[model samples]
Target: MSAAPKGNGARAARTRGPVHVIGAGLLGASVGLGLRERGIDVTLEDLSPTTVALAADYGAGRVRTAADPAPAIVIVATPPDVAADAVERALTSFPSAVVTDVTSVKLAPLLELTRRGVDLTNYVGSHPMAGRERGGAIMARADLFVARPWVICRDEATPAEALTLVEGVALDLGGVLIEMTPEEHDRSVGLVSHLPQVVSSLLAARLVPATEQAIGLAGGGLRDTTRIAASDPELWMQILGANREPVVELLDAFGADIAAFADALRDPAQTGAKRRIADLLAAGNRGVGRIPGKHGSSERFTTITVLIDDTPGQLGLLLTELGELGINMEDLRLEHSPGAQIGFAEIAVLPEVAERAITDLVERGWRTL
Candidate 1:
């Protein structure tokens, strides 16, 4: 695991030889596609031959042959349940190659390898915080990791060269690098990623028993909150199981918060109950405000809602007019009522342009709300 070329110097990096990718799933295929885009040779493998072939046909990489030379690096992108085993096999099969896994939970696989008494000097655990609700190679995209945070977990025993090779791959794929210990990475993802998936799944599960009338009244808030709930349950089960301790602790704390809120609402006439409810809601607002805005900053913007008819090209015409007015929309969301003929477009723009955007839309024979 000698030092790989620095940055994305294409020629220097391309000389590093074939990068082997195991699993040929969404993350693995995406990694291959990205590396190939940088002129690096990539070889792909998966438990299912059909999956590997699909990824190769999609231009992720070529299938490995016996005549293929040894790879410089091997990325284990198998599902969480089999990640440790695949990593172990990769290390043994490609002794000189630096081995890394992109598993969601880091500590579990590391501990498993340690328990098996496997030599981990060539192994470095990493995770790219990017994915889609769907899985498999068909959904893979070359830019999946672009502008996303990729965590590298390194300990004192991790060789510098091994760490550098993994970091280079992350950087080559347009990922922002962050270094963390195994414990820290697990806990961080447990809170930010795993917890949210669990919460969203449970919230959406509640809808299964709801009446059609109740579900028909759903709005953007419900849709946005439950979007990730559509993710594969089998995959999430493995992730949640691997990071059980931290996720359980987080769920307990969240349950307590829910209980307190319920108590306050149930006793509105009690002393300070209204104040308690308000305080809880205010705390939520502050917590949301703490999330990084754009480019990891906390900048705020203003939102303006405009009404559009459900007829074809109406929304496109509105956007065309917006562009003609030189208004840059920071973010946009469209929500429609069931069986209604109209929809609302919630557009986020700089605070200075919000009033003007509303006025311009109104003057142009469009409705604003």
Candidate 2:
């Protein structure tokens, strides 16, 4: 939990200004689009003229050409290496305005800015913990940040007005605010964000030489595990490079875990080896428990799988029937088989609704796999 910077809510409200979203990438465009939808004036900018134009065309905001006036709140959403420079440019471009960023690692960028004697008062650091594996403005969604934790890093010199302005933009975009120190943000993300990218990429990279038959056999588990491997390499390089130390530390720990897991598998001692592997798996299960439950509740889900044709309208029809049944789906995934018309759709619901949903769907001529 973070204490609000010393300021009255009324005073902070009065100081709000037009939000300028820089970079025009997915994260930036999403923020701009969401804010613009709230009737807030938003200006968008990107180094590439085409990107800026496309993002504006996508309803992010009006393009901030050179002739436009300086914006009130400037958000730098560029790569990690360029983020501090972008923030400096924003501050220079809009002297009286608040400035922040959507970069993952904060400490390195903050340190870089500090070395240049930049005005820290009007600048705060922010990282919205939401993104897609895809990149660019075209993948932007107005609700990308909805209900996600948007972490803000503030120092003593950071102005209350500046921090509040950023939080206001976050709230307007339907995000919950979280705060931490710059170093804390960097270390935490190195584990949660950076490490996952590296691990997923490593896993996916191994499939390059896999036989077509083997690759074709991949299912939901493999897809879910390696989904982040589809992320933009250029952007990830910058992020991982900037947060190298903490990421390296985490990688070392993960490497040790992997070695232990391997040793457990190779060991001939039956009981002890099985116990070792069980302990590692139990640790993983406990870690997963720390993650927020569906809709923020602790209740477990009961999953029901329905097999259907893989043709068009089949998925929609199934969902329509469930909708008409007034049965809410907690989670669902389609498992399509290769060279087969039928696919299994796994649907998750509340435990009490699970058996009932299965029975109803099956009674309606849908196959429950």
* Residue 49's lDDT in candidate 2: 95
Lowest lDDT 10-residue stretch of candidate 2: 5-14
- Give TM per candidate: 0.82, 0.83
Against the true structure, candidate 2 reaches a TM-score of 0.83
Clashing pairs in 1: none
lDDT of 1: 0.89
**Candidate with best lDDT:** 1
> On residues 288-321, what C-alpha lDDT tens digit does candidate 1 reach at each position?
8886653212134687888999765988999999
- Candidate 2: regions farther than 4 A off: 1-15, 294-306, 313-335, 344-364, 367-369
Q: Candidate 2 lDDT, tens digit per residue, 219-295?
A: 77898789889998998999999998999999999999999899889984866888889999999999988877543
